[model samples]
Target: MKRIAPAAERNKDPILEVLRPLLRDGATVLEIASGSGQHVIHFASVLPAVTFQPTDVDADARRSIEAYRAETGAKNILPSLALDAASDTWPVHSADAVVCINMIHISPWSCCEGLFRGAARILPAGGALFLYGPYRFFGVFTAPSNEAFDASLKAQNPAWGVRDTDQLLALAAETGFAHEETVPMPANNHCLVFRRL
Candidate 1:
């Protein structure tokens, strides 16, 4: 059965708006932590020219992704791969760009480190990595809501909480990526774009 994620549904359009100008036709986009698979379905429907490879660490999420692909009959959406951001090796070899939405804050900080390390290995020069989530700026929360969210996350798991934007950029720099842009999103989230150098 295909599970639904309300958050994915709400944020898909806003994410697409940013992706439209950045993505080129025929490029392969690898989506990390494709939770309910709703975002990939919506993106693939609109950007038919781009191939979408969705992956998740959870088996159920992959099933949901496969189900979404079946329901949509979208040719550009490929089969979901098993991938854990904290792993040193990724199953897929290469990609023109990567998209990870609402993942890092819910996972251990090591996941973010591994994500950038894996991205650096697979992406060629000038490739893009797009991330979406709420984050603190200069050790301060962007909004009160985000602060509460961060607190809740940390309460659940000490390793899980919204990361600092400056720390994230520094991590990316260590992995050979340069911070390109940060676009504000609805509900106090931000979309961060990076270029592999």
Candidate 2:
């Protein structure tokens, strides 16, 4: 059965707008934590030349991705894979770019560390790693809503909360990536673009 994420539906277009200029023809994009498969399908439909490889840690999410792929018959979407960001080994060997949306804030810090490490291993020099989510910068929350959301996330799981941008930049640097730019989105969320160096 297909599942829908309202957040994914709402943010897809804005995310695509940021991705449009970065991604090139025939680029292989590996998406981490592809929750409902909504974003991948939408991106693939618009960017037919770029192949999207969607992965999720949960089986249900993978099923939803496959369902969306079947419904859309999108040729650029590869079969969804079961991938855990915290794992040292990844199923795919390489990609031109890696995209992770709404994941860092919800997972443990170790997962974020592993994400950078794995991305660095798979992406060649100059490869892009795009991250989208609400974030804190130098101990400041961008919005009151984000502050509240962070509190709620921690209340749910102590490990989960909005991450700090500076910390992520440091981690990226340690993992052979350079912080390129951060684009603010509609909500308090931001799109962080990094390049493998």
Candidate 3:
């Protein structure tokens, strides 16, 4: 059965708006941590010219992704791949761009580092890596809601909490990426864009 994530449904349109200008027609967009697969289905539906490769570490999530793909009849969506951001090796070797939404804060810091490393290895010069989620700026949470959310996340797992933008920038710099832009989104979230150098 296809799983529905309410958050994904609410944020999909806003994310697509930011992605429209960044993604070129016929580009292959690799989506990391495609939970519930709702976002990929919506994005593939609107951006038919672009192909979407949705991936998740969880087998159940992959099944939900496949279910959504079959139900939507979205021809541009490829089969979901088993991918773990913390792993050194990835299933796919390359992509035109990488889209990772709401993964940084929920996973361990090592996973975020691995994500940057993997993206650096796979992306060509000028390739894009888009990230969306709540983040701390200068070691401070952007909003009170995000602060509370961070606390909740840490309570669940000490390693998981909102990441600092400065730290992420430094990681990106070390990985040969340049920070392109940061667009604030609804619910005190942000969309950060980076370009491979």
Candidate 4:
């Protein structure tokens, strides 16, 4: 089945703009929590020289990723794999860069911790880890819309909510990553970039 994520449709281009310069040609990019596979297909198409490895924990998400890859005929995209950020062992051991979009806030905080832990093990020193989504700054919401969104997320699951960027940075540091840059995106979201230390 081909599923659609409206947010993916809206944000793909903007995300690509940032990614274009960051990821080099012939590099492999591991995309975590690749829901609906929309973003990876788009990116693979746009960055033909780069290989995209998409992964998700959900069976449906994996199917959708394969569906989108088949539909797009993107040769650069590999078969979707089952990957959970919190797992002790990942299916793949290394990648040139790692990307996680709109994932941390929707999952438990432990997932974020696991993501960093796994990323630290997989990425080489100076490898980049990119994160995209809404996040609180210094324990305060950047906008009212983000605050409302956080509230809604928490309502759905108390463990899920917009995370504080400072806290995330601290966690990343513990896992041997350094926060590098933060770029503002559309709809009050942000793209955070980190480097393996």
Task: Return the top candidate by lDDT.
Answer: 2
Between prediction 1 and prediction 2, the one with superior lDDT is 2
Residue-wise C-alpha lDDT for candidate 4, range 1-44, written one tens digit per residue: 98899999999999999878889999999999999999999999
How many residue pairs clash in each candidate at the backbone level? 0, 0, 0, 0
TM-score for all models, in order of appearance: 0.99, 0.99, 0.99, 0.98
Instruction: Compose the digit string of candidate 2's lDDT tens values, residues 126-147.
Output: 9999999999999999999999
Candidate 1 local lDDT, 110-196, one digit each (tens): 999999999998898999999999999999998999999999999999999999999999999899999999999999999999999
lDDT for model 4, please: 0.94
User: What is the Cα root-mean-square deviation between model 2 and the actual structure?
Assistant: 0.5
Worst 10 residues of 1 by lDDT: 18-27
lDDT values, one for every candidate: 0.94, 0.96, 0.95, 0.94
Tell how far residue 183 is off in model 1, in angstroms. Answer: 0.3
lDDT, candidate 3, residue 32? 94
95 Cα displacement, candidate 4 (Å) = 0.2
User: In model 3, what is the error at residue 25, expressed in angstroms?
Assistant: 0.9
- Give lDDT: candidate 3, residue 153: 99
